[model samples]
Target: MSASMPQKRYYRQRAHSNPMADHTFDYPVCPEEMDWSQLYPHFFSPMDERHDRDPDKGKHGVEFADVGCGYGGLLVELSRLFPEKLILGLEIRVKVSDYVQDRIKSLRAAEPGHYQNIACLRSNAMKYLPNFFTKGQGMVYTMTDVEEVHLWMVKHFTEHPLFCQVAEEDLVNDIIISRLGTCTEEGKKVQRNGGKNFLAVFRRVEDECK
Candidate 1:
């Protein structure tokens, strides 16, 4: 590994975190209150300089979010695959998220123009997801080695009024489906141990009541 690259051993953390636990985390009051420029500097200009550019120049926001993004594997890959789109990774564990942040910094330093579209934030996605995204603006992609957890996710998402399970046929052309199980660190560990992975994709749909 390069000297600048973050070593995984230095970022070790417990395997599980209680999403319901009270952990001190700083989050934006709303999506508009987020200072995204700090995370993705290339996507935004200084506040004073924004008026001189096209209205759309700095209007881009994170379109893809990887919840519990371990080691930022998917974030790096997504940055390459969707160079024009902004991606963010949310990890709850402090050291693990710090490792991802450092990893991104190293990647950006190694290749100046390539990795600017992706960033990692240390946030509990379970509680803060809504604070970062507006209604009808999120898609969920999930893969896990635990059957019970996978089933639970499927059941809840399928039962939800605003989310519908995406059919397999509809995702045939989507390259991201293939990466869901192959890109993350946990996924790789499961693969190495000969574990089976259950995958699901869901899209947020318009509520009829709206």
Candidate 2:
């Protein structure tokens, strides 16, 4: 009976053994094995410049998107300039992306509304831009309004999507050909020359939000 009791005890201990002990670990993080190429390719490369040709094509001044922002300098500037405008910076590289995130955090703490308008996200801006802004609906501000000295200190901006559509070349011609299109009336301007340049503002004919 004593021998049988000892065998029973051994079997009981083996039966109750931890199931996780025999399981194999998938992997351990190794510094040398890390694929940094897949992580931070853009960290060393110069960031591509993004030009939003038709700035007024999206939703009104509720949000602002800084596409392909490197180190988020422009985003920070926009935040300071327009505290009420919600700003988002998109970057692709892992290290730089993390850096921008930390910057926004610190800025938010230092100034009350300094970083309130800004944020950073790791993403491919080109691919995700459409996701953020609909066809005829995005935050847009008139260059004239932005250039206003009085509105510089104003925390909030009145939301208006309306603006005159003008090409940068036409603006130059308006200055040179007609002596700043000086003699010409508002609706009676002639096309003296044409070239591609930044489209400052365009009227939103239809509300995509509707």
Deviation of model 1 at 164, angstroms:
1.2
Candidate 2: list runs displaced more than 4 Å: 1-62, 138-165, 169-210
Model 1: colliding residue pairs: none
TM-score of 1: 0.91
TM-score (C-alpha, index-matched) for candidate 2: 0.40
Please provide, for model 2 over 1-210, each residue's C-alpha lDDT reduced to its tens digit, 9 standing for 90 to 100.
Answer: 011111222212121223233433222143223222221221112123222223432114226665545456666666666665556776655555566676666665565435555676666544445554445555332221123432432222323444334344545643222221222221122224432111243335353321
Predictions in order: lDDT: 0.84, 0.42
**Which portions of model 1 show Cα errors greater than 4 Å?**
1-3, 46-58, 207-210
Model 1 per-residue lDDT tens digits across residues 65-111: 98899889999989999987889999999999999999999998888
All candidates: TM-score = 0.91, 0.40
lDDT of 2 at 26: 21
Clashes of each: 0, 7
